[model samples]
Target: MSNPNTPKEDDKVNALIEKCTPILKKMTFSSFMGYCGGLTAQKVGRGMAIVIGLAFFGLQGLAYNGLISVDWKKVQDSAVSAIDTNNDGTIDADDLKTYWSKLKTIMSNNLPDASGFSLGFFYGLTH
Candidate 1:
């Protein structure tokens, strides 16, 4: 006895599945290498190395030619200020402690480790 609502598997479904076939294509390493080599040869020019080097390393020349401005005096002043924290006439352990204390206070207030927020806020305000 079979239920009226249940469907049964048939031979026609099996015959249709048996008549179907899949086709596959094979690839070779030599063909892939040949294509890569052709692309490299076509895209890479003789002056590419020189152009890339100049683009990255030529900024020194631009700076020398006055295309850029660098404040040497400001850099020296900052270096001196970093060493002289109390603005006193000496660089001692007290200055070092003052510098570290300021750093600790800034770090704790910002809670930088808990959130990924940086001192970029202060940087933007100053700059």
Candidate 2:
């Protein structure tokens, strides 16, 4: 009773189901791994500790160099006029965050893909 050129509805549904089943199975496995044990939680805690330690060390080094010892009032006033791109009277962490965020975005967008040029140039520059 089906048309010669057209697939049956069950055949289409089965094809779609076949395409998605592996993806669903992989996601389920990953979720099970995430929630079934303390191992993932411990790893995340260790990673956060490492990041915090590195930030502390970097701040300490900056302090020793007098780089981060500027007067907060003057720095805030200067930063308000200088970095306030939208001219908003209030300066918040979001401004600095967005600046670095844009830098990362630009770097990623403009960066050349893995090619022989970069490797060759690095080798030439080093040697």
Candidate 3:
């Protein structure tokens, strides 16, 4: 007994979902990589505000995300994880210093470009 205005979880829909469950459950290489990438994006987005504030304070070195490795947790803390300027629970372009800054951060971390192999990559604190 359900109201016409309300939706019901019918067997057909459930059956369809069950049919696709196996495929979704199997994590392929692409899917696993995608999941990891998504997690990394979330981590970076959570620290967008801190990054912006750091930039304002002349800590531009934090902005450089070359191929070199750095403590992401410390970097994220600089932005203050709780500050959700975008109200999206993550520091994204909405609250970042600028759109270009956001792009730079993401690209520098995920894609090192041709310069990644160079020794200068280690020196780029703000790419």
Candidate 4:
């Protein structure tokens, strides 16, 4: 009684559920209720964290879409401004390279998460 031309619709639904069940399991009702339960500081903190995370992700998307542009040349100019130990008006490659070498000498240097960009965009918001 097997016809290879088509499969049962129930089988297709079962396959879809099997693929999504693991992800759905993680988002349980109790976990959501816990966050919405009390009006205490704990709930406030959780809500704030969620808001901040969402805002960060949204801004990241905007930046990626070119709705916002981070001014990287400003950061670079600031870093290299003091590198001209020769008192040159222009920033030559030699002076810039020297700055890079000195920067790497620092132990435990907390560099920016991205090149010419602030970590998590706090500076982008403030400045």
RMSD of each: 22.2, 17.0, 18.0, 18.5
Error of 4 at 12 (Å): 45
* Candidate 3 lDDT trough over 10 residues, lowest sum: 117-126
Off by over 4 Å in 2: 1-35, 70-127
Clashes of 2: 0
Residue-by-residue lDDT tens digits, candidate 4, 1-127? 7886665667987689789998667644433332233224345657889998897788678889999975557755775666665567567887757754553334114533222221112222232
Please give the clash total of every predicted structure, in order: 0, 0, 4, 0
The TM-score, computed over Cα atoms with residue i paired to residue i, of candidate 3 is: 0.26
TM-score of each: 0.25, 0.28, 0.26, 0.25
Residue 29 in candidate 4, Cα distance off native in Å: 32
Superposing every Cα of model 1 onto the true structure, what RMSD results? 22.2
Off by over 4 Å in 1: 1-62, 89-92, 102-127
Clashing pairs in 1: none
lDDT of 3: 0.53
By lDDT, who's the top model here?
Answer: 2
Who is ahead in TM-score, 2 or 3? 2
Output the lDDT of residue 15, model 2.
89
